[model samples]
Target: MSSSVTPATLDYLAQRLDELAAQFPTSPDAVDLVTLTDDIGTLGHHLQHAIERAQERFTAPETVYPPERVALVRLARAAAGIARALDTLAEALTYATTGFQREAVEDLAHSPLRNDPEVLRIMTAEKYVAARARLRHTAAALRTASTPAGSSTPRTTGLQTQPAAGPQPRQPNRH
Candidate 1:
């Protein structure tokens, strides 16, 4: 099943690649493209693995939990996206040059999507959508986690709610 990507994961993946790129041997002396590519390669593989696991667990007929299934699906999508991005980075790295052979390349190696406008925009969009979906899941989880047992009142769930004061005896109506 196809899954949507999230910002947290994207941010996490991007950061990993950024860190790796820091190890590349570039003109600036401090640039580390080779290391970045290696790091991203590893991250991509792990993301692919995550997608596979999510596929197995979520797509299984035996699992009936809607929320969990959805979460897994989302995770799978995000993982797939990350994997693809990493692949793209790897390809880009192969032809990679430093010191203004390409302006886009410089941007990419610097900021969000390494500061390349197109890459940054794409990553931002993916991150926003994914983050929203994750927030929804987190909210749902919080609601479920907070739900009280055997109480119909909306205010009476979990440890957050104060215990009822005391049992009150019913009084008979007097004329």
Candidate 2:
């Protein structure tokens, strides 16, 4: 089952893509990773609408030819993969930013954010199992980055260092 999207929605998608592309970092660095991930994550976020629209159009067979339907299916599948990867990459990057707590793996897995239907959709996809494991491994690396030489845990920087409990930039579906 699928639904229809209006021309105005498609226009908004195109415009958002344009805006993001223009805002992308001109010269990238460690700091730029955040911006890059944010832009790419936004792209992935918006791509979901394209997938939905394509699926919607595919269901409305009378409006498009057989070849068009085939194309729509292809686009939808492609969009799904891209969106999942984008989110995964962002998750990995964000995980790298802070000190890893052994409890974080469980904290995030059981966190309330996991209950969100959309976040669940991406997280439960086949790729996320590895992403979760990577989070574990990444946490070990964080142990190194976060703590002082003698400490076993992250030192307080007086900085709010925790990333959002789940896949970050978990954008609201903006279709």
Candidate 3:
């Protein structure tokens, strides 16, 4: 299975895993763990799409006569592992959240950003608006980079890319 898997596919899978690992908190609370679950889910979704794309490419009639069934099986197993891991993490988060005080949990749910005044300020600033536009542009470039060669359009994932409805009213500097 390892032999049949392409280097590019493995690299992308490893990169995605690295991203997930980087998001892991050393001493995570219920909220952090829940956020990790969401990140893991997104990674799993992207990995599934990548595996499907690879399978389609390898199984195409124009290429090799015999398909690599072992590689496909390995990919499928990896995807299942991802799903199981997410489920387990969610269960753990549920337990953690249950152990916390109801009011604390409610606070986490209602206003996670309330503790970080700088984040709130930055989020409303004109600079953040410009940075968000730049981020969107960069995300578009990354989508292009991940696209398979010879494909006309970039592959779509669960991520959405909607334009802002109107200009944001920038808050005055509060230093």
Candidate 4:
């Protein structure tokens, strides 16, 4: 494979991950949390596919494959981690919503008034607030984990070296 092609492919994969990360809901509702979970799973699948493709590409002779493979594997792991985080967030939301509803109903049943719309509404709102906070915290943690450590410096993968800064003197074209 041409050197140019490998970096382009990696860039595409990185862009896709960025897009998925951006789609995470800042204030996720129950329905939104479910959708986000599914989306995160899908992103994980895509990352896995990328890793497989990178491995396959490695079979080509005399090509720089090890570094690319390492990078792809790292990305796949990050994607899986993010998906797990999203799953945790989804579970927390489901639990909060259901537990709150159950407790509210049970509490109301024991009271003189069996059904109070205002009380139910207040409980639901409180549940939503608490769940939203948990989701935001989980999302923040996922973002932190997904980012590569020491990202301030360019990563040196395998035998490839960074190109020197400034414009290169052009080589004369051979007739």
Is 3 or 4 the stronger prediction by lDDT?
A: 4
lDDT to native, each model: 0.40, 0.40, 0.39, 0.42
Report the alpha-carbon TM-score of model 2 versus the true structure. 0.37
Give one digit per residue, the lDDT tens place, for model 1 in 1-175: 3232222333343443343333323232222444444445555554655555455544544542444445345555556555555555554454343222243455445434443444433433343334334333433332233212343321211221111222122122211
TM-score of 4: 0.39
Question: Least lDDT summed over 10 consecutive residues: which range in candidate 2?
Answer: 154-163
Model 3's lDDT to the true fold? 0.39
Checking candidate 4 for backbone clashes, the offending pairs are: none
Q: Which residue segments of model 4 deviate by more than 4 Å?
A: 1-5, 30-34, 58-175
Model 3 bad stretches (over 4 Å):
1-5, 29-34, 54-67, 98-175
Query: What TM-score would each prediction reach against the true structure?
Result: 0.38, 0.37, 0.41, 0.39
Which candidate has the top score in TM-score?
A: 3
Question: Tens-digit lDDT track for model 4 on 81-110?
Answer: 445544544444444345544443556445
Candidate 3 TM-score, C-alpha based: 0.41
Evaluation by TM-score, superior candidate among 2 and 4 = 4
Q: For this target, which candidate reaches the highest lDDT against the unseen true structure? A: 4
lDDT (C-alpha) at residue 44 in model 4 = 46
* Per-structure clash totals for the candidates: 14, 0, 0, 0
Worst 10 residues of 3 by lDDT: 159-168
